[model samples]
Target: QQYLERLKNKQVVRFASQAPAHPLWPEIERVTLEQLQYARLGVEGGVWQLFAEDGEMKMYKREEEVDGLAVDPLKAVHTVKGVTGREMTHYFFSPDVRFEWETTLEQMKVLETIADDTLVILQIHKRVWPASQRDALFWSHVRRVPNDTDRDAQDIWIACNHSTEHHEAPSNEGKMVRVALTVCLVCQTSIEPPADGGPVTRDHLTCKITYCSVVNPGGWVPTSALRAVYKREYPKFLKRFTQYVKDRCDKQPILF
Candidate 1:
């Protein structure tokens, strides 16, 4: 009887995401809010060094390592003329459109839908040569946070993804290397009333976006190569993702 009880407990932990009461849910909420705060803070001081730039987009990073592994923290901010934070959050959080914007993803699946605004997902990324392909399993949440600081500014929208476990999709299984990552995306929208006092159009909106991520490659990959890959990929990702959102939002009713 004791052995059977132990087996049941094991099974519960194995499928924790699907359990009646999910573990780490509180932590997920706390960390996600904290990430939004961090995103709003300005990146200054000597810790962050600017590495990439394009017009209104600027990228910063701090050089750091763990056991000789490159686990650099990245921050990027971009501004767009016509989209809202809600629209950006919508496309980013929706699993159906991920492949359209996330270029490196080879496969993606939603393991469980935790709620209307949250889910547990797994993704397999295309291999970066001379390294094993990678996979990530995590909980993703989307939220709207109040903007008390700027009374005139629209509410902020956020999408946060943090690593988590699953029974069927065990880590480091098969040929793929598992990656642990905490990624946060925050956006603030602003509106400019039409000069003609007419209906608000795309030209009357703008969005401010901040993206922060810390990715830990579970297995070893050359430090130089990892940094180079990040330097090249991060910029492209933000550009493509924002562009896609703008293109999609263009054809639809403005999400205010």
Candidate 2:
């Protein structure tokens, strides 16, 4: 109750000016590029040793830890039908439609619109049994990069979300456990033109998606439990999110 009151009364601070020329912009861009490279490596194999498979999705986790916390990085790649990279990325990056698809999200607030393509968000996630409720504050950026390999190929779209600090929302001082996380979603569109010269439809396009996340649960929790949650949540999250995009896009005109 006290925590909730503090949260409700906490003033929201805007850091618009800091974002445009923010010192973190360079790091964000560098990390984005690195995630792109990692995504490609995931597809090519030899890295990101596979751990689990579900239907069309293959999940992989690197062998590493940070400060006795399970910082095991995760990467998953899957192909979803009836969607383009642009359409999938739009839905993933937009917070307006997040609650409709994200099952674990309890509450989400946009703290600031840093830029047209950048934003700071605060989110509380529902408690998974044996673990305390978790909250995250992060900056998210979405971009489209040219595909240099195949000049004729569709542009790649990516959304990166990394944990950041805010004066109003101090971490580890509240009742909810803070989560330090960096997540990226990369999408590439594959389009096959019709032999009959017909209008391109949903069936002719697919989005190859790569999702990577490294979450450091603040405060110690059993590593086994954390891994269990990831094994269950990651695939479910991806599958549901993709299906949500596919269903919504089916009702509207094709985007990109």
**Best prediction by TM-score:** 1
**Candidates' C-alpha lDDT:** 0.89, 0.84
lDDT for 192 in candidate 2 is 92
Q: Which candidate gets the maximum lDDT versus the true structure?
A: 1
Which whole-number lDDT from 0 to 100 does residue 102 have in model 2?
90
lDDT score, candidate 1: 0.89
User: Model 2 off-target regions past 4 Å?
Assistant: 1-19, 43-47
Candidate 1 lDDT at 197 equals: 91
Question: Can you write out model 2's per-residue Cα lDDT over 1-256, one digit (the tens) per residue?
Answer: 9998776566323212245486668877787788788777734546567877888889888867788888888989899989988888888889999998899899999987877778889999998877889999998888788899999999999988999887768885768999998999999999898899999898899889998889889867889888888888888889899999988899578877
In terms of lDDT, the poorest run of 10 residues in model 1 is 13-22
| Residue 108, candidate 2: alpha-carbon lDDT | 98
